[model samples]
Target: MAPGITTVLDVRTPAARRQLAKTTVDLFRNLLLLLFIVRYSRVALTYLYGYGPIASAKMGYAALRKSLYRIFLSLPGVRGKVQAEIKQTLEELEKKLVPSGPGITRYTALPASGWGPEQVRAELEKLHEMKHTRWEDGRVSGAVYHGGKELQDLQMEAFGRFGVANPIHPDVFPGVRKMEAEVVAMVLGMFNAPADAAGVSTSGGSESIIMAVLSAREKARIERRVTKPEIILPETAHTAFRKAAAYFKITVHYVPCPGPTYKASLSHVSRLINSNTILLVGSAPNFPHGIIDDIPGLSRLALRRNIPLHVDCCLGSFLVPFLERAGYDTEPFDFRVKGVTSISCDTHKYGFAPKGNSTLLYRSAALRKYQYFISPDWSGGVYASPGIAGSRPGALIAGCWASMMSVGEAGYITSCHQIVGAAKKMAEGLRSRDTLRNDLRILGKPLVSVVAFTSDTLDIYNIADAMSGKGWHLNALQSPAAIHVAVTLPIVPVVDELLNDLEACVEEEREKQRQAVVEGKPKAKKGDAAALYGVAGALPDKTIVEDLAAGFLDCLYKA
Candidate 1:
């Protein structure tokens, strides 16, 4: 044989080689196309099933309509009118909010000359004397959970002790570190989390929720290779979850909490589950109606699909955990449920702690590790921080710890008894009174401290305004046009007063409706609540509402 002869066994002829090369190229090209289809198909499927097949189309249409409406309203005359209305509303808000009269002065900035300590103290006392909602008189809802003199003193003392301490430097503040740990441990114990369960402290319920969502998304990405994460929650779930979705780039599937029980629909949640689902959410006595969700149902569903479940007990907080102890019947909402993976509870609410305190608990340390941010290669000595903050207020943590310890378990049970007892009484008044029941319909069977009611026959917002007129503050909700009052220890003594005010407000609204009917005209009365909600609810567009909200925040910063 020749030195470089080509044979049949060594290689095919040049024509055969050309044919093989074309076949290989064609095979590679087809593989890439198939990969593209597979990747995009998963994304399409995630959204399609996350929202119902028809819901996706409807949402798309609504979004388009809203966008068009926004553009239309942005025209010169229209925009000017809208801005003028917002400005007027803000002016009215400022008048209602800030102190007034000849002696009152707003300290918009520091005095040009530094004041002596006594001068500062005198100035503070004058500001405190200014007109404000008398929360101490028990007319306000949800804001001041427990305002007892002793508890307030204890929190103030705790804050004084740790005012300068920062948890970011735990070594520098050992006592704060211990207190924060104890606070989390006690909360976890209350939830009946397993031995391996763990948690981290947060500034508030919103941060707790955000951390839980972040952990779920990260876990799904690392473990299951999911790119587009999705979460399913009840319609009654807190707005905080929606904020979390916006922050984390997660798609949200809202299951309607229909009439009657107003609980999360298990069937809807089941239908929405997909391979990309990062989390499932259930509220323990939701903020709107104060009705606890069917947690056992959601837990079973999550177990079947192997998805993480988060229970938001921010409003329920300290009270829901002690419901049975407080001699009230309860349902499964804590870590006892088999598939429950995480829970976010606010120490600021029913826990009676300082304002900036909450906890996010996880089923295990492994899951919680996902929430930790580590920078092993950082120039500044390898930075690592837990939760969403670098330097957190140790004073708040100390205050929270003091509140929880000072109250103890027995104290919490007693407070829950008073608060829940007051709430149930209010609900009973709405349900039993013939005229009141006929005029107002309770949204759900509230078993916790909140009671929400709607009126299909009259303007509930007007009733809310009337309550405000009587110096009673209530929360306004839309989608069904309702209002709610979250009972606190401060309100426990004034339950009867609340009932009386509610009855009067309802009658007032009913009379207005009746007069409008007799005159053959639509009932039109305006108040801050009425105007804000009525306009927002009537329009398909949210641009005006968004603008007003932004403007409100801006107003808070002005002098």
Candidate 2:
């Protein structure tokens, strides 16, 4: 039939014409609805499939618990009581943290007139002598990674020489620039990075991680046009990753690091991968448990998914790369592992550098450019920065470079052997000693310089408080309630004393538990750590805990 004849026949009747127009409108409406569904439901469907039913149910339960807590806190009498208790807790915290006595002087404001150099020096000496944790005596965990008095003198000299130099003006301070480049190059070589790899120096570990996260996010946005970015992180990964996600407005999917191995769950990480997953993170001996995640496993997943993988060696630093040379057990975590796009290592920790230096390395220079900040349209001039800070202290870079140069690979290997050996000895004592073995169990198989342990038969926080009373400062972990001692160079000589104190604390806590049971008491009396962690863990909403932490921070600034 002819086209004109068919059109004439089809539209010959008024009812037929009306039906055709209605059908056309219906088809257009249906097509628009289908497009809307596909666009809006993609992310939701990905989450459903990725998390599956069991994990989704757990998430739902957690949300419900949080909601219930909000309702409970809103109750009339409950709110008042909780507020009063929080106030009392903050007061106690302030009193303990802020020193106030006749002998102590508060410098709230600057002096009306400048003091002489001798007067300033005297004041500085007095301030340094104020009573505090004896980190120099190895009583504190992980805070001071001292490289010895000679290295300290070298660092001080470097600082004194480059005090006013800033790396932002490389032309003005070319020596500082050269030192910073050398520091990055040296660390990249340690991590087995390729020749085309590039890196930048940051203030510390947290900034390095933040830069890595930012790099991944920016790359995803520019290359894949992924606006709603998400990252998969092991639960044991550093809190800095969470801070980065919060700052960058990215979603985080936390895969659990279960016990026994306490490594990231490979299956869960694989399940969580989706189109929006810009990055996957695995730690090289995470801070809490000192257990390296299955980086090889994560690498395979990252390669298969075509997403970036970041290995956080901030804690491991110089120690991890030298593990094999130091004759210790090791795992594949650095650039030698395929599909690892970036790594963050703290030169400050194990590198024996000053506290303000760390490096973020990339597998390729192209990936690192995503972390750079540039503004060409500014009226002032074309501006660019390598990282978050505009003007970084060249003094820190010089100090870090000097430390690295002084403590060469041979020195680092020896340091690693000493620190790791001490840690292993502590773990062995915990396992073999009578009181410790009976009450406590080590978390994971720590292959590094940190040994974390928890107790099933006794309160771990009570043990922590007891250690504190004995002039030892240990790190407290939550979720499973544990304590960790990060063995540094200073702690190498005092391992036996640490083990002895730990044994005594365990025995004391155990005896107290037994006495409480015999007396028909519900529980033993709680100490400061016990009470603080206990209350924090029991509440579903962490607002009170946040407030307490904020109060502690405020006390640090109180004169």
Candidate 3:
């Protein structure tokens, strides 16, 4: 043997050997554990934090799921059965909504001779009488904001005076231009915008949002040389932003909102920012939850990053700015936030203007100029338009101006107080219920006039369908299935009735679900609402959803 060789292996006590064996095993196990983790880290990271190449893999899985569903639905028997069921359901719904008559007589081809104004007006009145849902009673949420007869009369009068006028011919219709400018000026004053701040009226909220996005995109491209512009928005931000992204060919990154509050996670937002980030968006009060983002924090981020910040106050409109003066607690989400570059507000929603009017406001004239579409080399001379539309209806602008003047600041404050107070009462009543208190939870701390509720135990969509049966038209939300009521002046008078109805509906749904479980009936897997949302929320291939949405839109025009 060699001189340094030892006899056998070094011996140790029993406890020491056991410890050595354990350590050896642990060392081997740890190596294996690390290998396993390294292998699955991509998946875990994607599932938990939505990061890395695994994100693409998850998207592929989603696409596969959607494709499988589509393929399954395309089987002969499956397609026929599903189509028949859909047809029956749609027929039932149409029967309930449409009046008893030959269904909507379409004038496929215009008459050789035009009907006179009186005849046309008479036909329009007849068409209006055939609708079932009386939105004027405020049965619908966020549809008809102000239904007072006085406002209607004022709008009609204003329309009659300016129906023939067009803002395009400024010299001939100087009054129209003046009124438009004044409307923009008045809205700017309402938000306390700086002297350099400017804006233009658009057809509605979507157009306003699109114009703002366009401005941000162009500004980033020209100023910062950002080629692949990306806009960061809260998940609760309006779907309009997605539409803008698609239309403008910009990238959109959604940041999730935190717990019970449903406000954007500023920490995650800070992490998401890259060199290509052109704009950061915060909603004053988002449509789904009616919760304002942490605008102060988002503004600070924008300031530090030197990115444009756009606040969507479309749904908030007249309510948010006036909440503080109306004796309700509110947050700072307006021009007061130094980094805010633009805002979109709908005059039609809470401003009580006629439908088809909204404002796109910018922090400065330099920013506003980016949104203008100008064609210098056009054959039809140098052409420029302030917003998306070339020839907009002056009648709507006139009506908007009239509505604003009629509902002065004091009137809005009073309306805000009533609506906000009623919404709070309804929320309180829901919270007080022992049955719903635990299972059902409000999405956020709503300071304005909207309240959204979801449930952990029961299907909230089923509750929504039940509420629909009771003639309460509440909005259905997804991601996590929930429903919301946008309280209006009319809802103020019937707040108790609404809460009572909601309680009854929830209880009835719970009973139905319990009976279904006891009888072993499949518990109504997921009704039409859930099925429709399932397809929408699941599909990574948005084109498939787009096709479905297009089909649905086409159905809206069915003869």
Candidate 4:
């Protein structure tokens, strides 16, 4: 035996060495096979458990459809037609979004010398005067939440006071720091948060939601050692949650919010929960249909499963909290509900705060700590941030604080009464009006400011186009082919106008369909909204839509 040979195994003979090598190779192969089976088995089981057999089958069918659609798109003629259509659509989008004229000067490059303040103001006035959606007159839905001229003036004054303030350096801007803390505290109190609850202001609703999702992910990783975290979201939950999951490298299990309630399915959410699930999400009056999920039921599930629940009240904002006080129906969705670890609310929407102001509330300070990013070792020295942003604009914080202070509880209750009252009235008109009822039907029972409706006899997108022709900007929805009017303060007095316009659009679309049939045509020509949504609905794979959307974003930056 050699000096390094083991006494337990004699490998002096060629036959012995060959047998040992074969045994070692076989052992490794078996291990690899076992690992492959274990990994795939877990994946298969997760799918079967998260989505039931029917839903899993549907998912498989959708994947197959996507593949087939991609193959079809790859064909020479089909590819050419698709590319041509997309190019045409993108051109139309650019024309609509990017204004261009002989008189319009493109500011593509900075001037050699900065212009005077008066010159810049004149240019801004010119920009503001350009043709655009007249949201001030209340035709638009949920874009601007005006709090009267007085409130606007006050917000402007506050902004001027803190023009260059940044909340990152609290010592330098103590007043802004105080205002930020008070704003969070006030909002937490509005949401019925406990004494131990904590919150941080963020740039907007999207950032607030992202922070909440990040907090849950961090909490799960630190406490439960969950390497592969997952989240269960209602189908109608804000898209920011999906964006957050994508950013954080977490898996998302979207439970369907099926009609007619258009709320998350508690049963499906329950089934989706596993040891790896980090958080559960519910929307308070989701954006599309304005239907609140069953939060109490979701809370119970969250408690039983020992997972955190985050209620997205960004759209709900000040209105949901004041609903009962305003003498309107409401649902349970706040920190008061057990197992709800976090909530996101936008002061900009119904709170009448300026843009770029939102808050994320945690059930306790410990939970909120997870969202904080602190670095102890850095060349620049130790640094910490409460949320995603590093140096936040204190002017927006001041504006938010001023807006909230100017609009006291009584004021919010009154606004809530007016807004929700108008929404319910619109919903009632849509349901009871003979012409509107004949063609259109409201989706879900909307208790919030958004009233969504779809038509069974006519194309809803066509009706949206007709509404646009009448200067009413309504939000178009998919999956059910619907349109929604998010009733704001501006829209309160115009509720009757909205109902009348919607009725006329429905009738007009019906007449067009009738005329098309009389002319021996398959259907009428598609309008802008009809054409865009038609293309979107027809595609099984949304790569084309994605490209068009990217093009639209590009148009936004075009001079």
Candidate 5:
């Protein structure tokens, strides 16, 4: 402007220069004010549309922590050492997970000559005998909800009948479609769903959870125009909900399930809700603690907020509905509760179905539609799918149907009595403190098949490792540092063995600790589980856990 001699600069004197400088400062101040407004306006709008200021601030803080941790890990010198350690751990993990020992054979490629079905079956038998968790003898938890031989035989027959069937081709495999529909209907009925309720069969509990989340998000989008969706979960809710949030770009809020009862803090959940909250989740005997959230309270909150609430009964399934019949007290946590929009039931868990079978039921048809995907303008043809997968395994659906039918209501009731009874026995044994260690305590009131126990005076993870050493596979939980056993039909008979091993493991750990204390050592009796959960619990930085998890997944694919 000075060079061009504009009118303003043409009057270049001391006073004029001072005036120009003043104007410049004023402009800069205005700009800063504008920036401040924009930043705060976003937060204000976020409060108006999403989680309120307190929750938003919490989320922002968590994000900041994550970003800072990421930055810390990005340093070249620090990264290299950490990576080297991770690599060594992964290598050791590979040996343990994908081991090739004396009796083990690694099949990296096909043989020169083609093998017959008999040879393949023989190889499979050997492969099955490899060092494993021994789920068959009821030493394993949650996994392999194997029904009796008769039920398994029926499921196998159904699978063989529909081995090549795909539900996507409804016309071609109408039987599979019918079986799926019937399975859903039967499951919904068991959950006390309304006449207008509808659902779709999914691959498993994870898929069912995914679809329920997707439906809630979509419904919010269409009805409330909520773009920035947020979901609320109990601290003990299944991890699938978090996975769904990550995949679907939804904000997740966790409300602590406090000690003693371990129920979701309803007040905290209420505070977390905002206009953009698409879903609220309560676990019907959530995986870790196996304690049901207050579904009635959740329902009241959902009704007041007009948000979809999902009951994750993937672990509960057949057992929960029949708990009362089985003489086990249960909280209301299903379609019977108003404001509960969806439920995820793993047919594989308690429905006595084959693995890879579950159902997601909606309270109404309108809610179910949101989970569907359709495109009429495709080049080839119109494409539509009920849930996530387009071409689902009809065999699994058939097996699910067969299992449900064979078991019927009576069989499920019997199973509930057996499994939940075993869980009750375990819980009773732990609480008795006469047979088990007095230092250990049960986590909350587990009303379902899963019974979680923690110890104030003992390292729970070390106890888990000791149990593992005794050929028992149980889930090690963090946050409270506990272990859980998911009672199944198989575990029902071996409940005594489980309690005995648990008591022995606790005593073993106590002795180890006593020895370490005498040797002037503070920490002792660390095993695979102890080290794993201890690290996971201690680290505020989860990058190590993430790295380990990724490597573990990679190991799963190794031949």
Candidate 6:
């Protein structure tokens, strides 16, 4: 007990001092041992799990699962049985896709001689007959927007009038140029853009998105002298942005969407921004869940940071801009927001136009000009094109213009009402179910035409398959797994049918699961979608998924 220690230790008690000393030493030794083990284990596991036998085992498991499925189909009598079933299914699908047989009207090669007008008309009729899925009946979603016979007739007449027109040469096709300009002007006005706002028509939504990205990248390079550029977007943004990143060599920083809301987390987005970030993207109503992001906040952030903000209104299209005017509740997400530099809207989607039409607008003409491709030193004279494609189809442009003109402002307002009204009704019906209400939940407060739902107590993919069996094609989503339906004019007419089918499918699945439990049978493993998505979610090395995706694409082209 020196001056510092005093009687605190009670050193006089030899047994107590001995026990305390031993305890202190043991605790220190254990702490050091834990640190050493943790440090070494990380390094060992990195190498062990990264390659060699352990990695090989995981691959083997995946291959075995795939092979087992194949083997099940290959069993002697089973092979014939399964092949017959598959053949029948394929035949049915082909019948649906193409209703006419080869004898009906063949166009295998170019005609030795051009057909006359009446012959062309007859050939067109036969081609039309071969189509099934009457999208005009509203059987399809987000396709064939305006199905009125009057509009179709008008579009057909307009197309015939300008069938040979090309906007590539303004001198030769002044009318085509004027129509394209007017279409862009109308869209700009619809979005509440300033007089200075300008745009160019594109082939479709993907081109519009790509053009916007290209403009942003060029602006960053020229204005900020940024050689290496990057863009920040929500994970919910369209895959087109990923394509843009790959094509333009721009790095993409993806921020996670917030839970329940399914919108981009503003805080995380702000945190990810750096000097290299040239563009920030927010979707007016993202496709998967149809949840609009906090565009105003994103715009303000862009304004404060002096970065470009792009709002993707592609899926939302005409529907979003007119939501408020149509007497529906919606958040502000357009050029009216101070920081929005550009927007992409699909004239083909809710705009009620034919396919292959979209508009990419900018805050100023200078911004739009950057999207143009020009080669002044070309040997074949100066070359220029406003978008990716040259010699564009004038008939498609004519059809788009006619649709817009016929629908006008009031028509769009009315369409929005019907579509959104139907969607809300469906959402309400789903929300009222006890089993589905408790186990399944909507992804967000969907204010648009799409409603997505996922289940906590069942495999949503199974429900998707069930819906498919009922002859309804709903989109299947992953990464927390859900399914969504984009309500359209056709869906509006048959929403009650959809809801009834959903209820029956859910009940049937619940009962099947209950029986499996009672009979002591192992629950059925995940179906095709779950197995595919499960592999995608579990793989940390993304290259494996890339290979899988590539293989899937290759399968599509196979005979």
- lDDT for every model? 0.90, 0.93, 0.84, 0.92, 0.88, 0.83
Please report the candidate that would top lDDT against the real structure: 2
Global Cα lDDT for candidate 4: 0.92
| Model 3 TM-score on a 0 to 1 scale | 0.85
Using lDDT, rank the candidates from best to worst.
2, 4, 1, 5, 3, 6
Across 11-107, the per-residue lDDT of candidate 4 in tens digits comes to 9888889999999999999999999999998988889988988889999999999999989989999999989988898898888778787886889
**Per-residue error (Å), model 2, residue 548:** 1.4
Q: Lowest-lDDT window of 10 residues in candidate 2?
A: 1-10
Across residues 349-370, which tens digit of lDDT does each residue of candidate 5 receive? 8888888988899999999999
| Candidate that scores best on TM-score | 4
Runs in model 6 deviating more than 4 A are 1-139, 525-528, 541-559
lDDT of 1 by residue, 1-559 (tens): 8879775532467877887789899999999999999988876676577666797788778889989898988999999998898788778877766556686676778789999999989978977776778898998898887748899999999999999999988889999999999999999999999999999999999999999999999999999998989899899999989999999899888898988889998988998898879999999988888999999999999999999999999999999999999999899999889899999999999999989999999999999999999999988888889977989999999999999999999999999999999999999999998778998999978889999999988898999999999999999998879999999998999988989988888888888888888898886577879988999998889877887788778777766
Assess every candidate by TM-score.
Answer: 0.90, 0.93, 0.85, 0.97, 0.90, 0.79
TM-score of 6: 0.79
Give the RMSD in angstroms, all C-alphas superposed, for model 1.
Answer: 4.7
For residues 74-163, write the lDDT of model 6, one tens digit per residue: 679976875575455445545444436556554567899998999999878877775455554445555556646788798889889888
Model 3 Cα lDDT, one tens digit per residue, 165-270: 8887788888889999999999998888998999999989999999999999999999989888888889999989999999989888778886778998887688
The residue pairs found clashing in candidate 3 are none
Per-residue lDDT, model 2, residue 321, is: 97
- Candidate 3 has its poorest 10 consecutive residues by lDDT at 43-52
**Ten residues in a row with the worst lDDT in model 1?**
5-14
Clashes of 3: 0
Residue 541 lDDT (model 6): 41
What is the Cα-based lDDT of residue 192 in candidate 2? Answer: 95
For model 2, give the RMSD to the true fold.
Answer: 3.6
